[model samples]
Target: MARKVYGISGMHCASCAAIIEKRLTAIEGVRHAEVNFATEKATVELDSRAPSLDSINDRLRPLGYLLLDETHDQGAAESETAHQATPKEREEAKELRKNRNTVRLALPSAILMVALMLYGMLFRPLPHTLYNPLAMILATIILFGPGRTFLRGVASFLRYGAATMDTLVGLGTATAYGYSAAITLFPPVRDFLGAGTHTYFDTTIIVIGFVLSGKYLESRSKTRTGETIEKLIGLQTKSALLVRDGKETLVDVSEVRRGSLLRVKPGAVIPVDGIIAAGDGTIDESAVSGEPVPVDKGPGDSVTGGTINRRGSFTFTAMQVGSKTMLSRIIAMVEEAQGSRAPIQNLADRVAAVFVPVVLVLALLDLLLWLTLGTRFMGFTEALPLALNSFIAILVIACPCALGLATPTAIIVGVGRGAENGILIRNAEALEKLAVADTVVFDKTGTVTTGRPAVTDIVALDTGTAASRILQLAASVERLSEHPLAGAIVEAAERDGTELLECSQFRSEEGLGVSALVEGREVRVRKPTAGESARPEAAALLEEGKTVAVLEREGRAIAILALADTIKENARSAVEALKRQGIQTVMITGDRAETAEHIAREAGIDTVISGVLPAGKAERIANLQQEGRTVAMVGDGINDAPALAVADAGIAMATGTDIAIAAAGVTILKGDVGKVPLAIGLSRATLRVVKRNLFWAFFYNILAIPLAGGAFYPIFGLLLHPALAGTAMAGSSLSVVASSLWLKRMKIG
Candidate 1:
């Protein structure tokens, strides 16, 4: 299946998103679809028979929504460069202007509503003058002007048989306004019933008036939710210093390509992902890596775009430019993750799909029941007014906007918060899974221990040669070998400033080490064969958890060199932290039992899965899952990709290979194992906030819907006024937004 993200237009609330989601899911070749109301984007999965965008839009356009390909730049919904006026800014301006214009047009209706409220409080005998031409004129301005969006919702229903939150507002206010207009325009209808000449022009004006005000406030608050994305975009540098033929020229960053040389000045942002060619500096990479410490970079080191050069200046060759840069990928990942829907959001979508229509039916049925039977208990005059009150209140309060905003708003904020902490949550499903994981499995190499091997011990046998002489011979041959252990011996020789002899005819074996003719003598550094046994000194070094390389002349062991992989400083602390959280930590390695056990004990890992090859790592994780444990895998190697994909929640270190990062759901940017626990804590906090938001949304509707429906009216002698119901409905959605915003202030680390 191929997945894609498209900008969607004409979404007003959760219901509008639900309608489009269901419609798109029904399309041929589309496997799944999720429309995020907060992000205003739809993530769709398509099969091999991929449907064209035009076909998808054709189905959606009739329902007043369209899908725009982000690449075409037509009707583009969001932009990455923050300093420019982009499509996102224009759309926001348009929405805010639309509301302000409506608020102005509804001013007279608002004033009239206040006058009616004061007069109705003082009088008992309702008159025909209450439904006069002046009131009808004001209500007409509201229904056509400020209520235009609501009318559009009604038109959508009439044209496509789709109902949304707007449908509720449109139907309720339109019913009240049409009835009141008929009573004022023609006296025959009022006299035909012989009931009363009462009109609900006041209900029509006040309900829409209050709703428009609440919508205006809600739009302002919603804009603040995208601040994190905007800040990330603002980090991009607009230009770079181009270096060519020993001359410096300032050019746009877009002009810099692969192999192009760009110079970074002190305090300037790195132009793109590149390798340092000259000079060195202290780089403040906190924005990209979430590590508080500034990193020192010299020649041959890699620098990332958007990181600031703090002290010195350097020039580098651009390896990754434009969208391929780390910062750009991060922004894109954050956006997609924010747009992706959580599994819990399905519950909201299902409810919103049927909520509007059910409320419409309930509103109509209650109105009919009140008009027919309520006249016996109270006179016709009181029954007609009470029925109108119940009708509008029921429709206005059960809008379901709160239900739609519950999950997406929190997910957006949560994903953004994770990005700020150097943790990239790929999607909402992983975020949820990580919050509940019970066991964390770590790949031993390059994860718990630094992958770089170093010389730890060296001892000479009874060969009458000094240990330093053995080191010189081994380093001389190992310098010609490409093995990592060979590099460690060479580096140790260099550090000791030992004299080296020129070697000839170097022959290196894969499983064994290398051999060379140095000064007409046969010198070899090789592993022990099946028949060969290590000396007592070598066996003691092996027991100390170090790999021993045997140095021999004439196929006999003369000296022993031992090397060990350095354990990360924070590995032990990271394990202890997980254990403190009641989580089990296991180390999986390809080393023999002795080395793996010793490393596990040193790193505080409770269990060790030793002697497993790279292919068996994923199986071990699956086995852990079969034992009823939620497994989270952490690794930083190409071999860890399969295990990362198979684990419940895969966290990849930034220092790892790209394939491993791609296979994982979460990424720690700085390659710090300590961040593993911090990421889990943040995920847990985010999930808790989602639960709280969901509860509040469900609770508000359960309590408010019945009150508006007059379930308690008969006994409590209480009825929810239409205006108050509208206010409460708006408050419900705003409260959810506020709850999501609270996540921004949490300090996860």
Candidate 2:
């Protein structure tokens, strides 16, 4: 299957997304469709032989929507997005202008209607021949000039059979305008219904004016939410000093290809990701890593694009240019993460899917109830006007905008903040899961320690050769192995100027030790395992809190190489932080029980599970989960891949193996264990924001919908006007968006 993201044009609410997703998924060859209302995009998975774009567009045209293929001339699309004003900016500007124009046209009519209402209340009503025609003319201008958009939307709904915010607005406003026009033209029909009846031309103008003002505010607020991505893109310099044919020439950043040598000056941003070929400089990589400190760079060090060369000038061979640069990848990842939907969003989507149709039904019922039964309670003369006002209010006030905006707005803000802090959350689901992890399982080496062990002690027994000879022989055999402990033994031998003899017939036991033929004798080094033959000397060294590797000659133990790895500076504090949050921290290692316990104690871990082979790590995680714990495994090695995959959330350190990073859900660059708690803290904050948004959205509807339906009119003599309903509905959506944007201000410690 092939997956692609297509830009959608007419997604106004979450219900529109549901309709698009349902329709797209129903097509042949399309496996799945995920439509995001916040991003206005649809990610679709389809078989190799996919349906035609025309077919997809044909299905959407009736709904007054467009699905743009993102894969067409990506270079052109990027250039169009970056060089010129973005599509979003253009659309928002257009909306703002349109809203301002509508307000300009509607304000005069609204003023006239208010003056007419006040004149009637204070003095005798104006004659229908004079004031009624004036009101009808003003209303016609307002309806056609400022309210034409809603009218066009209604036309689409009638022709296409799709309902949206436009459907509700167009129906409500058209009803008020049409009723008033009838009352003005046919006075006898109005007199038969009620003697003191008046046309509602003011309501039509006020409703459109208020709804336009809300949309203008909403468009402005949404534009601010995209500043994170904008700032990131702005860091890339448009031009670069390209060194071609041994002569320097300034060229567009896009013109610089891979293998091109680019000269970066002090204070200038690097044009592309590359290796330093000549000169050295202090590079400020705060834009990419979020670390404010400048880093020293020398020849052969890799430099990323968009980082400023703070102090000296350098020439670099561009390795990854254009979209392949690290900066581009980061932007793309952030975009994907922001567009993703969490499991919690499913409830919001389900509610939004049926919200419009249900609101329509409720509005109809409100009108029917008032028309039939309202006369008995209120009076026959007031029933028609009350029912008309209630129907209009119910239609205009009941909006699904808040419900659709709740989840995606929060997710977009959360993902952008995480990217700025050097945490690349893969998806919304991973960030959501991180908030619930209670048990944190860590790999002992590289994760909790420095991962670089030194040979601290070497003890020789049985007068065969000097301790130096034992070290040389052990180093010779261990040099063939790539383990960290093996490097420690070899480094010790090399420091002592011991000549190592070549080893042959080498064999390594996974988690146990290694054996090889050194100097025509069988030499073996092993960390003692349970139920395995061991020496008393090895036990003594193990009890001393050292990683002991015993050497044997002809299957007899001879010497012990005791190594110790230094604990990381932040390991203890990271463990303490987790413990303070009531999270249990466990260290799983392949070393002996005594060594594992010692390291655990030094790192402030409460539990130590030791003597487990590399392959059995996942089993240990499963056993822990059996005790009803949500386990999050942090590891930085190939051996930890299985355990990482088995845990509820796998956090991979950037210093770790490629397989471990691939298996993990969250990857923390620079391998800082302290960031684990920070990720959790950020997740909790984002989850809190999401919950608050959902609750407020539901609560607003629950309270506003009933009031709009005139549920309190019988007892309180109150009725929510359609204009106020429009204002309240607009405020509800704006409030949800404002709440989501507030996540950026959170300081996750």
Candidate 3:
């Protein structure tokens, strides 16, 4: 298997990541693909013999995804180049260059359009000499100058043995110009033939000008969609204060190597990924984690790159500098994601590929039918107008605007709605599958509980001390240790504001319990002693399922502090909601069976698969799929990666590590389980909209083609002019956009 990483652009949430994975997986020889919305990178494993980068790139472009690099090579090279640009300087220079180009093209195009309109309406009936010469000059500039891009696109399609909407417009306009030139150069030929005084130069110029204006508008709208990522990339600080030999010197963030000590001041963005070696302040991690709360940091806490330090001065050694920083990876991921394609976009592409050929055939049939009728009153010269009209009509009426808008427009609306609800959909396709999740498998520890242990009930064995008093002594002993369980016990004591007696020479045994000398007595907490029977009520409580942390003094049992994993406040409600949607909820955990059962019961989950390792979790997911269930795995730990990768769909919590996010298909930005249902609802809604859009796009062409081919002209004597054909084409494109915009207002369940 060959592994390649792509920095995807335009991934705003987890759904976007899913879309990329789905698209890449469809490629033959792609063994596996994983996309992380937060990181915005896709790691794809493929059989090198069946697929190539060129084919992948071609597939992604039409879906609006851009693959930044096939491997880490280009990103490493670019990081060195970016270090020299100074992020701020680079952004300003890029903006200036883009604005200059936009102004250069837009200004002249606007001027020529106005001049063409003025000449057509005001100077149309001038002497033939002036009219013909001026019209020729104006038409040439309008077609060749402002209209060059569309013409070039048309030419490219033809060169590739295909056709696009641009091909139709280019051909129709060029044909009009050809007819106009024929009339101008040989007026005597028309007079001798008694042909009507009709020339199409004005029509070609006006139509191409209007279409160009529309093209510009479409380009500007697309730019707006990408504005947020650009603003995000623009916020990075160009340089950081690097401390070397007791002197502080400014160096580019990319140039600050790992192991270099860096100084971060109040209100400055952290320039490199590093640990807080000496800081007593809070850092805003909202940009990276999507959390609104700022976390307090002290020595030994890891801080990510590109986050802002709100208050306090700190110096830290850089752990990950240059392109390895979280911010750089995110930027690269977003770039590649934007370039990734959706599966539905492929249908639009296939339809567009055949569109021009079908139109040409219909136009030919219309002309042949009219000729076979033997209407000699109008010669071939007189019949030419009808033929030209049919040709242009066929081209204009078959707009694939709705087909183009089907997936993207629905996704934009879905993502925006999801964001408002604290759910971020990373891509369009993920939203589609999420709407149909049949089974939701949750990781028990961090996913269900706050991932923290808490005191549930207490049991006293033989000692006369009350359970509360035993807990106080146990909490006192635990307060002197820094283990996770110790922290839990200490926090519980603090929460209850219980006075903790000082413990001397506390010794904590790994995987066991702590022992300490408290108040001139030796206190030890450990697992329950053999043959130590609990009181009747305490025994019943233990049987009802709770973890008992036993307390002892002088080798005799005192009391037991019962601990349990508490369910999140929203966990019950979220599970109930999933059940209402007919989804089966299961809990998978590496925790002991009793602990898993306790948590699962509290969360109201239907099934609990306990004592499972990462690989076992994956096996369970596969088993569910083998039984015909569409499974979605939700997790936040690195251990959950394999299971998440194997599930039909994987959802990683926002609190999850980079590896978990990289392995999963979706990343819940708010870390809210409720968003899982919301994502599912949005996916169903988006797919519905895609279906409707495609239906209208294809249906409109089916009905309009025959009418445009003059099917009703025999009875009504109605013929569509090339100008009206252009208008109808514009309307068809606009109709698709309008329908898609209407979807933005749709109420998603």
Candidate with top TM-score is: 1
Q: RMSD, each candidate, Å?
A: 5.0, 6.7, 7.0
What is the TM-score (0 to 1) of candidate 2?
Answer: 0.83
Q: Give all candidates' CA lDDT scores.
A: 0.84, 0.83, 0.68
C-alpha positional error of residue 309 in candidate 3 after TM-score superposition, expressed in Å: 2.0
lDDT of 1 by residue, 1-749 (tens): 99888877677778898899899999989999878888788889999886899988889887888886655232111212224554445566777888877877675677667777777678753455744676788889888888888888899899889998888898889988988888778889877656466677777888888788778777777777777778788788778899999999998676777999988889898878999999999999888888889989999999998889999988999998877889888988898888887887888888888888888898888888788888888867778878888898988988788888888888888889888878998999999899899999999888998888888887877569887888899999988999978999998899999988899999988887789999998899999654444567777778867888889998778888889987788999999888887899999999888888888988999999999999999999999999999999999899999999999999999899999999999999878898898888888888888889889888988888778867788899888988888889889889988988998997563
In order of listing, the candidates' clash counts read 0, 0, 27
For model 2, what is the alpha-carbon lDDT of residue 340? 87
TM per candidate: 0.86, 0.83, 0.77
Instruction: Give the clashing residue pairs of candidate 1, or none.
Output: none
Regions more than 4 Å wrong, model 1 = 1-3, 25-32, 45-58, 72-89, 107-134, 191-199, 455-541, 548-562, 747-749
lDDT of 2 by residue, 69-109 (tens): 65524553332223445444455466578777777777666
Best candidate, lDDT:
1
**Model 2 clashes, total count:** 0
How many clashes would you count in candidate 3? 27
